[model samples]
Target: MIHNKYFSEEQIKTRKQQMSSQWDTVLKTNEAVLIHSGEPIQKPGGLDSTYPFLPHPAYFWLTLRRRETEILLYSKDLGWIEFHKEISNEEIFWEGEKNDILISSQGKNINSLENFLENHRFSRIFHLGQAKDASPEAFELKTLLDKTRRKKDASEVSFIRHIAEIANSGYQKITSVLQPGMTERELQIAYESEIFRNGAHTVPYETIVGSGSNSAILHALPSQKIIKENEFVLVDAGADIFDYCVDVTRTFYSSGEMSSQHKDLYSIVLKAYHECVAMSKAGVFWRDVHIHSAKVITEGLLQLGILKGNLSDLIEKEIVSLFYSHGVGHLVGLRVRDTGQEENLNPKTYFGARLRVDLELEENHLITVEPGCYFMPAILESAYQQKKFYDDINWTELKKWYDIGGVRIEDNILIKNDGNENLTNCIAKTEY
Candidate 1:
């Protein structure tokens, strides 16, 4: 059985009030006639079982409830209204009683949903997308609530901090007991067990415990491969606490003694990590931060004789994509990849092309700053085939480190008005 916990009633009320105010402003400004919530979903093949229900982040941001068959309707004059199905005794016996924590805490006004369609009709309904139960005439909302969700409120920050603490504890547990010959799968179990023991509801994403050559794969799955001495282990994992997530990554040397090449590469990645953290502040464009991180990695590779050309010229030519392809970071909140976007930001560059969130940093914005360098044959070979950066890259020297795999150091950061705060700062770096 899974144990559940929630924020205090006062905290829930505050979040509700904030959401209501935001909705009020949005409805009035857009002159929306009505706003309708999306419906829930169920599994296809299961007889009576449903997939783990995760409410739409926008819906949860408003109602905090993960109900399966409920809809929220809002109007400027009527305020927020909920239509809900009355639970039967059979359901109570089979599925357990409805907690109604949100209703009781906020004293929400709910109405029978049996005849909702017959009683109400809307001409201009704003919705995120089409739903089976929603009106076909509904028009898409120009700006989604995702934009407003960028800057978290007090309660959100608290939840994320708790997640970070849990993640830190899990990392500490794994590092203290890790040993050579342990399978990647074993490490995954140990880390996940620690997360559950510390009160995390579930892992935010798949637990990555990549060892040896597997570390070169950015999103490698934990396998039965046994870790060996002198190899690197890249563990990128996080836990979910009440839907809030914390993403963290750490790379460790299996022998507990870093090789000369490993030391040099680790130092460079660590420097890039800290430099990105220092540069993440309110009003800073995320694209600029990404570019700065790529430049740092490019410069480091050049110093290591891995690349051959002027630093600026190499970076401008997208040579950094050969090693550090993924984005330096992304927004983190209710979901691991939080929903938000900037109209002017384009994340189509060869480097940092997979950026999930691209917007100017704002106060209370939580994100992950993960910088990495990998020796992946496919990515490098593809670039070489395209004749991209052939002059800047020293393929012969890079080939020597192919077996070295990769190194990544990641942390959760909260952007502040003055600067930023690293939420996972308590977690020790793998260099130790």
Candidate 2:
């Protein structure tokens, strides 16, 4: 039931006023701002007449208004500018007025965006689409915002932890309804239905519902595969609420019993997983976290006999590419890849080095510490054949586990003043 007393109009106004103060510096420098209000595209040839709509997460965070064909305007003179589509009879007939619901419910101004901007006369307009390379100042603003979100204010933490609870609930529902003959798509729908039932409006991204050999593909697209005995099920799904997200992954048995091989891999991956988490805190370079995580995975694989190399050689060669391909994790916020500058762990003389943002860890940063070891053929072959160091890898053992698929564990973390909080913990390893 929707609570009529929840977040009263006055409370929202106060919050918006507070946000305006926070955005003051960014506004003072830029004359005009351009932000998009995303309109979801219709599914191709689907029978549903509903036009799907989702506001861009960033736009939602800045304006607190969720409507299509509207733009947010900001300048030094004007406190805040809200723009909406001009309603005409023809337009209203085709698209019933979205203004009444948006304005009344959200307390946003109902003014035409064109008129708002045309009258203000900013010398230049800046939008992400037109940016070849984002201005350094804009990048700095984004980083500051990232830092702000890292430590969840009481309200932000409450929202994220709440989403984690919903995600955990979805996992529980999936387990109860799961059967050997179910298709991946059907299972995906079941899990997502639970998310919606618990008040989550959108999945942070695509739901990964892989079963059987399909589980080996790290970011597997849900397919027609049926769950089978002695096979693994890897699910990576998330929930986005008020532009904050909880990313969680859990792999478990569909048959309520684990195979010997499955248990072995699970144990190895989980051990490395905990090690990665244990090392995270403020002030540690992310590169150190990444490489240390890689070391644990590499050692675990070497012990599994999937890879054969001296410990240093394996770590140096990154021989574990036969198992893992992607970086441990990225920043998570308004965007799954939250806005930030790319920083490096090593000060190496390389081409991408120039692109790296010499960033130092600071308090109150939200980041995802995900570490996975997947065996993908395209990446595996390239690493072994193209790279000199990886040339000595044991191809025989690698190919055996190549069919074993992959394992990825992800969690959204909040860097605190002294330590960190795992916001996605509720959904991690959800056997309850």
Quantify all predictions' global Cα lDDT against the true fold: 0.75, 0.65
Structural similarity to truth (TM-score) of each candidate = 0.88, 0.79
Q: Write the per-residue lDDT of candidate 2 for residues 1-432, one digit (tens) a residue.
A: 111322234544554465556657675554655656655566778665546566754555555556766666555566556665455898579878654232334223446555666776777665532234387655544444444444444545666677788888888887788878888888898899999998887887899977866877867888888877666778888886655677788786778677667777777777777777777777877767666777888888788876676888877766665566556666776556665454233543211112132344566567777777666666667743547545456667767766666666778878765778888776647331
For model 2, state the Cα shift of residue 110 in Å: 6.9
lDDT (C-alpha) at residue 28 in model 2: 56
Tens-digit per-residue lDDT, 327-362, candidate 1: 888888888887656333465564646665667898
Q: In TM-score terms, which candidate is top?
A: 1
Please give the distance, in angstroms, between residue 244's alpha carbon in candidate 2 and its true position after superposition: 3.9
Superposition TM-score, candidate 2 onto the true structure: 0.79
Candidate 2 residue spans exceeding 4 A from truth: 1-30, 34-51, 86-151, 241-243, 340-361, 377-392, 428-432
